[model samples]
Target: MKLKTALPYVLLLLPLAAFAAPGSQSGEIRFTGQIVNSGCAVARVGALSAAQSRQVEIKPGLKVEVDTDRNACGHQSLPISMSYEALKTSTDKGIVTITYL
Candidate 1:
């Protein structure tokens, strides 16, 4: 009974405790990997608020479909814009073929 009452508060502080532990120290993490049939990787993912969703703009492009999207989440019809941060120019391209057995 008591544990249940304190559970949420405890859970919140658990991470804080870990951060303050004796061996805890600031650090940086870097990732490097290669992907086939893809030019740019997914930098990050997040949810869009109501205002953010409304400001989405669409552009013309060839349609590439993923047969099964294992990473699909959030509301359908939410707009996502592509930026060419990893590409040399807006005309750069990538070929992504998804296959799963």
Candidate 2:
């Protein structure tokens, strides 16, 4: 394909590339604390629900967007790396219990 023809596809991939970068994916937050702190750890003050779940590698100082259960709040940034296994357990109704090591 000509460079001009391929340009569109390349441009479309920029955003995808950004997300794939380590800097973008560095925000894997695993909440490890009391059930009471699940709010702050996950960083949601109120009850939050996860319609869908995923396994991710969380890094330090990265902000995780509260994809689901955002009805309660927005930008509940998690400053920790939540484990892939523990996050799965915390996505239920009421309190979400979690831990990190």
- Residue runs of model 1 more than 4 Å from their true location after superposition: 24-101
Cα lDDT for residue 49, model 1? 22
User: C-alpha displacement of 23 in model 1, angstroms?
Assistant: 1.7
Error of 1 at 31 (Å): 26
| Alpha-carbon shift of residue 8 in model 2 (angstroms) | 0.4
Quantify all predictions' global Cα lDDT against the true fold.
0.39, 0.45
Per-residue CA lDDT of candidate 1, range 1-101, in tens? Answer: 99999999999999999988877346856579854322211221233222222222223443332211222212343223443232345455643332221
Best by TM-score: 2
Q: Pick out the ten consecutive residues of candidate 1 with the lowest summed lDDT.
A: 65-74
As a whole number from 0 to 100, the lDDT of residue 13 in candidate 2 is 100
In model 1, what are the clashing residue pairs, if there are any? none
Candidate 2 residue lDDT tens string, 22-46: 6644778667865533332253423
Candidate 1 lDDT score at position 19: 85
* Least well predicted 10-residue stretch by lDDT in candidate 2: 65-74
Count of backbone clashes for each model? Answer: 0, 7
